[model samples]
Target chain A: MSTNAAKNLFIYGSLLCFVVLVILTIDTMGKLDKRAPEITEEVNAGKKVWHKYDCIGCHTIFGNGSYFAPDMTKATERKPKEYLKKFLLDPRVIKADSAMPKLGLNEQEADDLIAFLDWTSKVDTNDWPPKPILASAIAGKAASAGQALFQKHDCSACHQIQGIGGAAGPDLTQVGARRPDIDWHIRHLKDPSSVVRDSAMPAFTDMNDEELKALAEFLITLK
Target chain B: MKYQSHQIALNFYTTSVLLFLVQVLVGIIAALQFIWPDFFILNFNTIRTLHINSLVVWLLMGMMGATYYVVTEESETELWSVPLGHLQFWATVIAVGAVVVGYIVMGLNPQANTEVFGTRLLNEGREYIEAPRWADILIVISVLLFLLNSFMTVMKTRKFTAVQGVLLGGLTFLALMYLPGMFYTKSMVKDQFWWWWVVHLWVEGSWELIAAALLAFMLHKLLGTDVKVLAKWMYIEVGLVLFTGILGLGHHYYWIGTPEYWLWVGGIFSSLEPIPLLLMVWDAFRTTRETRVPVQNRIGLYLTVAHAIFNFVGAGLWGVIHTLPQVNKWTHGTQITTAHGHLAFYGAYVLLIVAMIYVTVPSIRGDKEFNQSRGFQSFWWMTISMVFIVITITGAGMVQTYMERLLGLDYVTVKATYNLWFWIFRAIFGAGFLVGVLMLAADIFSIGKRPAS
Candidate 1:
């Protein structure tokens, strides 16, 4: 259902994305006020997580080599974004036997990962999920709070979290239970920035400590 | 005096306020989780359910209460039937009760606990949708009667003030939005789409109508502020929020996998929606700056002004930071989004309710100067606490987002990265909110007068 993280050329390309939007409205740019750019935030969060953990030390992406972990030449295909985001939260979540460190990704930054990893998994690589030899990366169910999230975030009317809901996202039917807590959920949830560079999961830390803890607990429970 | 809906109004108000206290508890717990992933009641599914369900229930209760109060005044008649009102109230309780049962008891059952709570929820919460559907039914039925009751009263003897007009409009939309929320489908996208018509539209859309109505009535009565001026401001506020707020719907679309167009639409529109609220802050301050006329809810007014300003900065300014399609493309559903939701909700929704309490509590007591000293002092403390929470949360979220996204780190690492700040900030904010709540409780309970006849 997913692909390995592909070394995207977009890191550099994403900067251009901002440039294009600004250039199009360059004339009224001054007239237009500055607001936060959340779409980019998800990706940036992911990128930051990637950097903070020194992922490059253990993994190679876009062909800059590494022998420690699998090459991310096609990581997007390897796991779903949920898998990636969760993995970043706790590497051991995905592979309890993994030697990789749990990089301590907070719950809010983790949500940014779904879109970023979704993008990464969709990279136009020749082969997908990178390791056909490896079992398919399971889909992480929508966080148990997924539906509540839909409601709390008002995601239901536009995007369904579970069945009996909206139509924006695919039903998170086994996203949690099925999806492995490997590189997919953990890495993506952490920043989503490294892979896609521009994502939509805004920083969820705006929620109070209680909300974040509860939401994270709920989302993680999806499996 | 024809409308005996005073009881209905009082009942709804009572229920909503209590629910708000519940919401506060849930909110506090949720925030604590972010700071300490393995803290008390760390079960994600249960906690998330508590946070979200309580928020919806409390907000709905408040709207229902406000609606009953305003409609009776507008129509000058008893709600069509007291029996019907009783039914709706009970139905709402049952429905919310069902939802709670599912979330805390069933949804978060230990078998469902996976690694981190968020993921396990994704996995296990899905299987439990059927249970909550019963609650949904009660909500629909109760709301239907509510809408009909409000409309019936209005149609019979509609005396519209700018205040009442806003109330009428809000009640109408509340009815319209519910129809779409009833669909059953496998598509998360479609599900989310329809739900927002209920949730988002309520806050940004219809609920605002209610807010405006409540505010208008409260203000006019308190200060004899000209309804005409208030109406004009309300009109502008609604215009800006609608034009841009509808686009604000796009903010929910980013990670849902609907289409890229939403990214642009949601990103641009929602980002801009906060502008009106920002302007509202300026307008309120501009209007009130020179006024020496103090009212019962002067503290409430302070809270209202604070809400608008924070809504501008927290929800508007901060929301725009990553609300763009490109940014949403990257930042969606992350801790970054959480930060945005926190400040935005607190500034926009919570503050309004706080202001409402300040206003209504005093009015009931017939005191022009309600707890003047304590109320004013409490208002300052609450605002300061709000600022502190928003700043720390935003800062922590940004750090997490950057660390995870840019660097490709894991979740645990990000948590560890900002570990100290998260704990300290959350604890501080939590303590402040608790204090404010205590003061407010005292203010309301004391009532500042002898027992009513």
Candidate 2:
């Protein structure tokens, strides 16, 4: 190829691509506000809170940032908001060995951060971060609904099942074998201190009778 | 050195090497923290910021130095102002030092946006461009001074070679792309959109131009290739790089809250990105075989060849693996990205800088000939260990995808259990890579000390 020909190829080809990219960028920018329309004062403040601790340095949002922690794009979808706030204030409260360092954020800051994450969770990512397939495969009929509730309420944060969970609560791998009464299990789940005096486990009054029954049935099958 | 002012490159090269050592050390700390979470008090995020920041600073320093060295000889004159070059170099060094100290000592303040003029006064907390606003301004000043020195020298000669033109173009865009990253946005998606203008456009777009021109210059000098032939191919190669790379920015956009059209634009364009890199490797081999002259600096040639091959594998092949939105949806934030990142950066940019050093340092130091044993050994050690690191990390990523994304396992559970062995092996390979770097440092520092053979 002649030098001039090659130079023109470089110049024109790059110009063409550059022009197209600019047009697409403008179009995308115009559409971004509508796609992620949750930019309230609290959400903006939450974003600042995220930056203040440099959370992107650990946890990613939109699959950008350091890979030290889980992606927070759908964090609010996975964990309850109140639980997330408490966990943020003191991570060790939920999981004793959580490597997340306590950042001494105030209650307001934690709320704002959650708000930011909630807004982020709603952004259209073209179905990014596909749901895990193995969870469905391992989720038996009884375990499916109850297991989801287990994760939703963060039971594994304190309780261990089959030696795979936290140590704060008693090992539930054989809890069903010991406490075989379904009614007793339901009462304990609803009000932990009612069944056993001074129980540290939080009461799950929010869970209905059906959820509590499903969780108990799933727990008994753990053995 | 051909000109007295060419010696300024040595200072930049010196700082670049030192910062490289700092990056590697911090990288080791980060890997350790990954395996054993409580290994340090500073935590993984802070250490990681230092690791990434240093890598960028050192690589830019090396690229700047290489540009100066190349432009002086190409223009057939001394630099416009050696004193200004030195001033720019030290100013950059101080800015880098202050930024490092700020991250280590003060940490990031959550209220930085409010405290400063709509920018972070200390650490910006953004990935890669994490330097505070002051450091960011210093970087711009340093780049401007360096550009002025270079442009004036070439202007005086008024004889522009294709190599100099392309190099200058690359450097100009490199400086321009950085400006978008400084613009802050309250919207997280918009912030990331511009952040990539600096990151993606840089490594994929402008740096490819710089790498291609520098490689062309090196090949022309080392192998006595015809300037016209190299220029023609260089133009074609970098033309394709920019053509594909500019639109390939969509790959990053696919999952960053951008419009859905990115999935198609990013997937198609990025898949084509590998074609130019393949052409680059093919052209290098073709040039080498056609040259009748025996290469005196065999290590330089070895690294140059390796740079092309590894660039094809690391940047081109590995990048395309997940560039498609279909595959990237599963592997977006997994260790798969980490695997591709390590090899791509090391292969494309790291090896290029080191190759430039190997080619020029001997001539600069007045060494008639030097031992090639350490240089060759370091090359194999780093290349082998790096490939292994990528392999182990890729394994970890696939497992992570299956457990976390596929099976719907909790992120922490998969991190704690399924990927432990891969992390261990990755750490081991990282240590091996560090040893190779130390040997490389030894070889570079030993350039003038050895007796001419």
Candidate 3:
């Protein structure tokens, strides 16, 4: 009886040791990243650069950033390329304290990043806060020039994104998902919603059709 | 001090001590499994079953013992069937032993050609313990005997006092309500359906009735409060319990395939269930505040406070948090549910029963003030223990919930994360509760012939 008991105990202990070894080996062997490295690397690298420039410190995206600067969340929602290229060169025309010191850029990297942002805002994020806006913001291919026009008109003074703030305006993170189309936005930019009874965005009828389209297209996709 | 009947009080101490000991062992094993997942020859899943099932058993045993004390005295009769009580006492012991043994079989069964995560190994937990549905049937039978014995006593007397009625009703509910368990097919929806009928109904429904009358009886008997006033409160308390109680089962139905209507029902009504329990506690303090009764068995007094603390922890906070279907959506089947289960079971039901024992056991000696200070000191001890239990269990559950649900961490990883903390928490609480039980035992049995002083 004693020998049998001892034999049983040894068998159980050995079995336990053996099982642990197998599980550990299987776990290590199956370790895999599963996502394509190149695309992931590019996106992750852009996120790091975006974080470092502290672009978010001055300009808001997805409703976070400093209040004094224009919200760049709608940068991809542009209608004209000329509006973006012209404004990137002249920062002060947008605001007096436009604390947005002109960060000089060659058009190539600028276009890539704007394209990246455009791609990001169009992903189907369901109803969660970050994903949908990021998906659409990345998709608004021509919205950059219009983004520049809104800043030129000093819309940054009233609005905020990601967390940067303007005291007087509405958040435009998912506004592409929230509001009506370009005609309404342009006419609203031309008149206050009170006079218009439909637009809180002061009307920008004063701007030429190209600038109006830039701003209108940007606001339209927000919802 | 008002006189308490001693025969009733003695029964309480014997049961409370046994329960505390069971908890200590269960806590130790639960810790061991965490310390090493394959701690035993088998798996953590089987280990988890033993831990939870033992907890349910010991707690039920303790509560039944406490009810025995309250009912026997309140009816103004010697226990109507002491023999049946003893029979029940042995049946419970065997049932508990059977469950523990069954789990071991459940664990070791996984040993046959087992590899981790193998479905074959996993099936062993259910298969080896293919306890003929007879095991649960046995438990129900034991409860039926207890119910029959208790109810028959009420019929023979042809009188039901507030305390006897509540205690009788509780025992009957414990027995009859389990009828749902028989119809419980293995589907998650059906199982959860009837499981909550027994679980929810016993804890929140009939159990509340017992707590009120027991509290009223003990206070009126010990502190000299008017029974009539307490009885009126008991009436209101039972109404409020049932009014909120039946609907309170809606909380369980929330996550199950039951219609979304249960969300509206459970979310609203079950949240309201704690009000009466809280009101009863307030009434205890307020009614007793005006009268000062010199006391015997201060251990019993301390047990009363332990009772109130655990009642709040187990049935109150735990009940309220998981009452909503949305919260239950994530917390259910996770450690969050376990945390609430432990604190609520031990703190509320288990502690109240212990307190009832503390009050009644010393009555037979006809001494109002024998060993008063020690009992009160133990009361603080038990209260502090319950606080540790509720806090730690809640923390452990929350960690598990976040890991498994929010973080999407798999089961093994989630269990490993808070495994150490559960052991540590159970150790401290288990030790403290055991100490309180020991102190209570001395008061009930009386350590040394009362010093002739």
* Cα-lDDT of candidate 3: 0.55
Candidate 3 backbone overlaps, count: 67
lDDT of 3 by residue, A105-223 (tens): 44553454454454444422111121222323433344477776655665544554432223234556666776666666666666665444322343455788887788878666555
What fraction of the true interface does each of the listed models get right, in terms of native contacts kept? 0.00, 0.74, 0.00
For A1-223, candidate 1 gives per-residue lDDT tens digits of: 1111111221223234334433433432232222112235565445433433334433434322222244343444423455466566776544454445554557775665454444334433222112211111212234354435434653332222333222222334455665545445444444545533434333433455555444444544555
Please tell me which predicted candidate would have the highest DockQ against the true structure: 2
- lDDT-wise, the better of 1 and 2 is 2
TM-score of chain A of each: 0.36, 0.77, 0.34
Residues B1-453, model 2: lDDT tens digits? 567776789888888888888888888888888888878767787889988888999999999999888888888888888889888888888888888887875344344333376665667778888787888888999999999999998998877999999998999999999999887688999999999989999999999999999889889878989999999999999999998899999999988889888889999999999898999899889999999999998898888888988898999999999888878998999989999999999889999999998988888787568888888888888899999999998898998887677756566767878888888888898898888888988876787567656
Residue-wise C-alpha lDDT for candidate 1, range B41-97, written one tens digit per residue = 434335555665576677677677667766775567777777888778887887777
TM per candidate comes to 0.64, 0.94, 0.59
Lowest summed lDDT window (length 10), candidate 3 chain A: A124-133
The DockQ value obtained for model 3 is 0.01
Could you give the candidate ranking by TM-score, starting with the highest? Answer: 2, 1, 3
Q: What is the TM-score of chain A in candidate 2?
A: 0.77
Query: With candidate 3 superimposed using the best TM-score fit, by how many Å does residue B155's alpha carbon deviate from the native?
Result: 3.7
Model 3 chain B: weakest 10-residue lDDT segment is B119-128
**Model 3 TM:** 0.59
Task: Tell me how each candidate scores on DockQ against the true complex.
Answer: 0.02, 0.58, 0.01
